[model samples]
Every structure is written in C-alpha cells, then in structure tokens.
Target: MQECDPDHLVLAIENGEFERASEILARDCQNRCVCSVSALQVTALQVAAWQGRIDLLDRLYEKGAGVNDVDKIGRCALYYAAHRGNVDVTEWLLQRGGYVDAKIGVYSCTKGIPYTSLTKACFVGRKLPLPVCWGRTPLHQAVKNNHADVVRALVEHGADVNAKDERLVTPLLLAGSATDRDDLKEMTKFVEIVKILVAAKAFVNIIHPDTGTTALHHAAMLGSAEATEILLSNGAWPMYKCKSSGSTPLHIVASTGSTETLMVLLEAMLPHNIDTRDQINRTALHRASYRGHRECVRALVEHGANLAATTKTGTTVVDAIFAHIPRPLAFITEILDSCVRTTNNSPLETYDNVLLAFGYLIVGFALSFAVLFHGNDQFRDFWRAVVRTVVMMMGEYEYEELFSAENGRGTFLPITSRIVFFAFIMLSSIVLINLMIGLAVNDIQGLEKEGHIRRLLKQAEFVAHLERVTSHRIFRGNWLHPRLRMLLHSRRDIPTKITLFSRENYFHHVNHLVESPSKIPADLVEALFLLATKTFHKNDNLTGKNIEIGDTKLTSILSNLEEQVRELKIHLSQFDESEIVETARIQNKACTKKTVNS
Candidate 1:
C-alpha cells in the first residue's frame, strides 16, 4: 500500500476534496503509518457537513481521526459545527462520545449552554442533528445565528431558552439584534421567533452586562419598528430602565434618532414623563437637541417633555444646541422672542426699597454696637471725635466749598481757633478717607462674589433656554423642505475655489482687485489671475500664459501645496482614488501657477 503524506491529506480535506482525501487514505492502508488530524481538519469536516458531505466526514472518522481534536486555541469540531448550523455532524460527534463540555473560542466562557446536533440543523432550516465536539449546545447556536426554527427545535429538545452566555446575553436578546426586520416580508419569521421564545417563558426583560440594556432597549436603539412591536406585544416592557444610564426604552429611542421607533414608543402609551436621565443628568431632550434630531425633539415636546430641563452643570438643552450649531445668532434671537411672548408679563419688583432701607438701618446699628463693645475704648473715642469734627465743619462752611479747594475761605475766625479747627479738620479728613476706602474694598469683594454666582445661574438659564428654543424651532423651521430640495437637485454647482479659502483672506484679495483693478501689481495680479483660472478649469488645463518665477518662490509655493495635499489626504482618505487624484491635480496646478508668477 502507498504511504500518505499527512500535510497533503490535511490540505485535501481542508479544500473539500473529500474524494481525493479518501483515495489517499485508502492508498496508505497497509503502511502502518498514522495521519494525525489537526483541529483545523476537524473544523473542515464540520464545514463539509454543512455542505451535506456526510459520507466524507464518515470516511475521515473511520480513518482513526480523533473526533475531539482541538484547534490551536482549543476550539474543537463541535465549535465549528454549532457555529455553521451543521446539526447532523454535531449529533453524530456527540453520540460518538465527542467532548460535549469543551470550551472553545474567545467568547466560550460566556457561551454556557451545550447545544445538540438536532438544534444546530434546525437553526438554519436544516433537518438533521449532527454531533459536535465543543460544549456549545444547539440552542446557543440557534440564538447566535438568529435562526428561529433551530431555537424552536432546541426548546422542544428541552434546551433552556433563558440560558445566558458569559456576557449574560440570553438567546432571546441575540435574535432581536441579529436581523434588520424593516420590510414586512423579512419581519414575519423574526416575529414568529419572538412569539416562540415568549411562549417558552424566556426572560423578556434580560439586560446585558456591558450596556445594561434589555432586548427592548436594543430594539428601540436599532430603529426596528417591527421588532419593537413584536417585543411589546410579547410582554416586553417598554419602560425597562437601563441599569447603566437609567434611561427608559423611550429615551433610547429619542437619542438614537429613530423617528419610527420614537413614534412606536409614543403610541405604546409609555409614561410621557419617564424622565430618564443619564449619569450627567442629561434628559432625552438634551440628547435629541444636541444631536440635532428635529423629529425626536418634536416628539418629546408633543409628549410633554420639560422644555426648561437643565443638566447637572446647569446646561439647558438650548445651551447645548447653541454651543454646537453654527451661526446660532438668528436662531437664538427668534427663540428668545417666542419665549418672551409666551411668558407672563409680570414686572420683577419684588425688592421693596423702603423695607431694604429699614433693614440697612438695623444692620448699621447692630454693627456700631458690635464695634464699640469689641474694640478698645481709646479707638472708640478717636472715632467719635472724628465724626463730631466732620459734622461741625459741615455746619460752618458750605458743603460744596469744603470739598472744592478752589472756593475761597471767605469767613475769617480767630488765628488760634482756625489752627485748632484746621488740625481737627485734617485729622477728620484722613479718618473719613480711610473708612470710605475700607467700605469700597468690601463692596468690591461682595460684587465679585455675587457676579460669580450670577454668571453660573445665567449659564444654566442660557443652556435651558437654548435647548427649549432649538427644540421648538427645529420642528417649525421647514427643515425637511430644504433638505429634500437639496437632495433632489442634481445640478447643484460645485463650490468655487475662492469659497474654500478663509473668508477674510478672500475678501482682502477681492477688495484689492476692486480698489485698483488696473494698478494691481502685474506679478500679484498674475498670481491672482492664475489662481482664478485654475479654479474655473478645475477639471482641465488653463489657456496660454507663461510667467517665470525664481526657484526660491517656486519652492515655497510647491512646499505649501505639498502641505495642503498632505492635509487633504488625511481628511479625504475615505474618498475614492480618482477623487484624490483629481484633487491632487488641482492643487498641483495652483502651486505651478503661483510659482511661475512669484
């Protein structure tokens, strides 16, 4: 008998050349040479089973191949069979004492349930129960593949429907996320699967460990209206709060910008004031406004969302929108006007001036006693003398003349009396100035503290106001009309070259041209003309015009163009190759023109 090369046999099996592999195995019958099947080979057999080549797998098994052989990372044949929905292969291997408890692959710890071969085949509409080596049960595979038939089959076979993976994600959760059931035709099967799971008593409100989101939360997030309907009908609670964000399903819908999902959630009669907030105290309206979801904002408003809601930091939904949306001046003004008209027209005269004066008098009396009783008697005496002198001087001289030095001292008194009086007056003046300075300092500090508090309050109010206004305006702004028109208009002109440059620089260049169209320096004008020509002929070459420039200037222009191209490459990496080439050509032309005229 001929000897079989282990490598060639393994390759043949891997490539699905089962007949050739069988031939090689037959030829090496009498050599007493054994061929070891790698874990990859076992996986290949599972793939073959998926293709209905059961005969080939049988031959390989008869050739003394280890049914429980694992791959490099410890994944066995069962892992592949379960993953590919090969029920017959999985069942056969399991019956042959295949390791049904082996953990394989990255998420093995999370994939707790061991599915049977029958379950695996049922998942993808196959009718056979193939055995597998790894511990993942057929029910687990069904949920992973989102195959309703397999899931139903496994349930019939006594598979636990509520079993969770290492990540705590249940089979029901997986089915809801696997498919996009937007079209009615595609939704029927998934709807049936959900009904089956619900009938089997699967946990309808299972939350994921990482996101703390339930299956209902995921459905809302995906904008799958049909899935949402199915879940809700099957007793999936819409008000299930996400453990992480504390957001209800409606909040998730609003933030995801799923208009259909939002409408569905609203129609379900979920509590309008769910008021679920994220860690930062940002409500659904705050998220919708920040993301510029006009429809979501409108939905929230119609559902009685608090327009005056503020975040933990006192940022209102309006403030967040204004901070993000460009050219917010007109938008903000319009919002403020609307708010002013809607609010009550009561004047804020709550502070009574007479009461304030009385309070101040009481405070002054209290402060005087405290100072007199606390301080030294000598200091108190000095203060009293100063106050008396100030009052006496006021009585004798005109108040204005005392303050104004230019006024003459018209009334003459005894020389000794005047000296003593002047000395008293000087001492009183110094004390009065010092006291006034102290009061001024205190007033300034108080003002500064008050200003800080006012600024914070104003910021919070502004954010709230901006959020309210933007939310209202987003719905009323006729936004859909402009967007639809823009989308439908195919003849929209491309932006001009001048528009790409900074507005200030472009204005300066244009003004220079208008100021002295002819007197514009020949070289400078040539440079401008060259740039303009390149702009017009962006997709083509320019007409005849040659201007020689020095190497230094040419090098500078080339360097600038290179820098721009580098930046453009970074920004436009996702663009097609042809687009990148076209952009490069335009940049090169601009650089050449600038260099030639420089």
Candidate 2:
C-alpha cells in the first residue's frame, strides 16, 4: 500500500477517472499496514464513498483500505456515505465492518463531555448526564441532512431510530424540525421523511429532555400543515405542553401564525379545547393579538373564543391589542370619538374627602383646648376647656355663660385668654375648615375636566404594557441572552419579591442592564417605537384601502336596492288607488251619520 502514491490517487479520484484511480493502487496482499493506506484527514475510501463512486471505493478496499477508518473525529466511511444519501455506498461501507453506533463528525467537539462535579469540590453545580455517544450517530446525520434513503437503510440495519443527541433530541424529532427554507417542495420531502420515521414506530411524543419539545411540537413549529396532520394522525398529542414554555401545539400554531395547520388541528379538536391557556394564562387569542396576526385573531374569535379572556396578570385580548398595537389612538378614536376615556367611580374618592375633614376638625379642637388652658378658663380643667372649644367651633357655644358677670366674673376673660381663644377660632375653626372645603371642592371640579388627560395616561400605560410583552416574547425566542428575562419578572424561589417596594429594587428593576422602563432617552425610545409604529401604519393603511373598496361595492348594491324599492312602490300605486279612495269615502259617510245621531 505504501508503494501507491497518495497525491496521484487523490488527483484521479477528484477528476472522476475511476479506471485510472483504481489502477493507481499497487497490488497488495490482504494483510498490509493499516495506517499507511489512509490519508491524513479524509481517506480516499471515505471520499469515494461520499462521492457515490462505488467502483473507486471497491478498488480502494482491495488495496487494503479499512472500511471502519475514521477521520480525526469518529466519522466512519458509512457516516459520509449516509450523509450524502448514497444508500448503495452506505450499504457497501456498512457491510464491510462499519459500526452503526459510531458517532458522526458534526459533534466532534462535544465528544467525551466529562462529568466534572463541582459539587464534589464545593456544593453548587450538578452532575450533568454526558451522552455516551457524545451526540450524533450515522442515522442522525442522515436524517439531519434529509437523506431519507440512508435513514431507511440504517434503520433497517438495526440503527436506533430513537437515539438521542446531547439535548435528547431524537432523529425523528430532528427530521420534523429541519430548518425550513420555506419551499413547498422541501416541505413535502420532510413530510415524507416523517412518514417513514412514523412507519418505523418512532415514538411520537418523546419530549426532548432539554428543550422539552416533542416530535409533534417540532412539526407544529415547522408550520407544515401536512406534516402536522401526519403526526396527529399517528397519535401525536397536540395538547402535550413543552416544559420550557408550558405551551401546547395549539399555542405554537397560534404563535407561529400557522393558520392552515391551525385549522387542521381545530377541526379535530373538541369544543372545550378552544380557549386553552398556556402557563401564563395567555390564550391563543392573546398570542395572536399580541403578535398582530389579524387573520389568526379573527379565526380564534369566530370559533367562539372568549375575547375578554385575561392573562395571569389580568390583561385581556382587546387589552393586549390596545396596549401593544401602535397608533392605537387612530384605531380607537374611530370607534370612540373621544379617543380615550376614564371613570373615577371608586367609592374611596368620597371617603378620602370625609377623612380629610375629620382630621382637620380634630386638630382644630386640640389647638383651641390648648390655647384656652394658657390663661383663665371657664371650665375646671383641660378636658372641660376642650368640650367648650368643640362646641364653639361647631357654632353651638353658650354665649350667655361667658358674659354672665356672675360672682365677680367679668363680661370678658383676661387679654391673654381672649387673644389666644380668638386666634384659635380663626386658625382652626375658620381657616382650617375652609381649606379642607376648598380642597374637596377643587377635586370635584377637576374630575369632570381631567378625564381626557387621565385617559391619555391610561393609553400610554397600555402602550407601554404592549411594548413590554412584545419585548419579553422576543427575548424568549430571540437568539440573544434570554436569561436577562429573570430580571424583568420575579422568581418565586428567589428573594427579589421581598424588596418590591424598596427604592433600590425599583431603581434596579427599571434601570439595571436596560433602558429605564418609563423614561428611556427620547431618541432611543423613538427608534424602539418606530418599528412598531411602521408596522401598525402599514397595516392600518392597507385596512383603510380594503374598507374603501368594500364601501364602493356597498354603494352599488344600495343603489340597486333603492331602484327596486321605487319600482315596487309604483306597482302598488297602480293597483289600489281607486279602491282605496272608495273605501275611505264610505267610512267617512258612516262616521258623519253616527255623529249626527248621537
């Protein structure tokens, strides 16, 4: 085998000169040095196998090429053959001692994930389950690359259809979850692969232990109506919730805007399943509206969904739309000419006023008693003075007793007592009571005029909430750091909830690692809101044009109906004028005769 030049052999193989490629191999006994026959990274045998050059592969094998020869990673010749969809090459490779369970080259980096127990060193981390195969098998590569024939060949040769990768995603799940190019023909190919896997008895509801996605969930996510239908027909549970999001396939469909697939699921659903909520109590309607899927929202509503359904945080579908939909003022103002409205109907408003008045009355009474005690007092003690003071403040004082002049008592008290009492009367009884009255009256006057501003504030808060929900959804599905979501929401197990009212907590919640929730800088805020507003304006403009077209069609129909009504009235006039007049004349003559007799 060392007598054969590696460079010349590779050149012949590349140029597809199979005859010369085969002849370049030196005559070799069956027993030869193993490593010398193989090249550095990819052996010629593997290349020929991947290229589907069966004749060149046969020549290499006769020259002492090992069928089980692997690259630096554990990718065998069968792995390349399987990935390339060359079933005949895969069969030849496997028949010559290729192991089905050999790991593929794709996961070469993830091999031998050591079980480093930090718990043994300190006590924090955990013992993660390292996959023994380190990840992909030949079958996984075949299914991932859409080599359906290779998939069949391996499965028939006793490959594990249920083999799990590092994330516990199986070959069957991988097939359904192939990154869609959005081509219809590619979609059909995936559907066929799913059918093949299902015929092999692949488990339909095996959740990826990491992502918690099932085969059905993956198919739903793919948005292929036919693939979803096939999975459902094969006992895929549509209601199985993913552990990560606690969302069923129905929620996935609504979120993905897969209306056709949604219809397929809905037609097979029981009536009670229509309003199923996810973990956050967001119904499919809420999902559709939050994402601005107008048609999906309409379909959900037409199916008798509860439009007023609330999330766990107490927001309804209409609320979601109002809060999140950009340019909501224009849309809402059309139906509500006032744009926004508020109602201050709480009973507490009046109760607050009453409390304010009572508090001032107590303060006034206390001051009057304290002043009366500073000098001469008509009463025996401070308590007596306080009683008298209360009476004087309410305008029910006994004026005759203070001025009686009985037993050396004069018509007036000393100057100090008189001045103190009079000042108390002015400060407490007059000034303080009037102040409370003014405040109460002011509130009443303002409520009537401030409704519009209150409404605007309410609309702003609604829009902000919409922005928050949309951003949260994006982070959950975005390719960014999703762990940042923990800051937005409090965890039950964490102590963040304890500081809910603390200043530092409020500051951090609004300002830490993010723009302030309410007061982002104007330019940045505009940029953030611009995308939402543009989508809204585009959609609203389209909607307006559609409405105009419908209005034109409606006008033509109304004109036709008006002409028909006019023609029908003319026909009725021609039939009954003479007969109607004669009847009226007879009735008038009878009435005049009866009146004269009476």
Which candidate ranks first by TM-score, i.e. highest? 2
| Per-candidate count of clashing residue pairs (backbone under 3 Å) | 29, 0
What local lDDT does model 2 show for residue 175?
Answer: 82
* Candidates' RMSD to native: 24.2, 29.8
Task: Write down the TM-score of every candidate.
Answer: 0.43, 0.47
lDDT of each: 0.57, 0.65
Off by over 4 Å in 2: 1-23, 26-42, 94-98, 104-135, 321-598
* Deviating ranges (above 4 Å) for candidate 1: 1-8, 25-36, 39-44, 50-52, 58-78, 85-138, 145-158, 176-196, 320-598
Check candidate 2 and list the clashing pairs.
Answer: none
Candidate 2, residues 7-96, lDDT tens digits: the string is: 445545655666776666644344231222222234667667766898777777876888987755566678777767789998887788
Query: lDDT: which candidate is best?
Result: 2
Candidate 2, number of clashes: 0
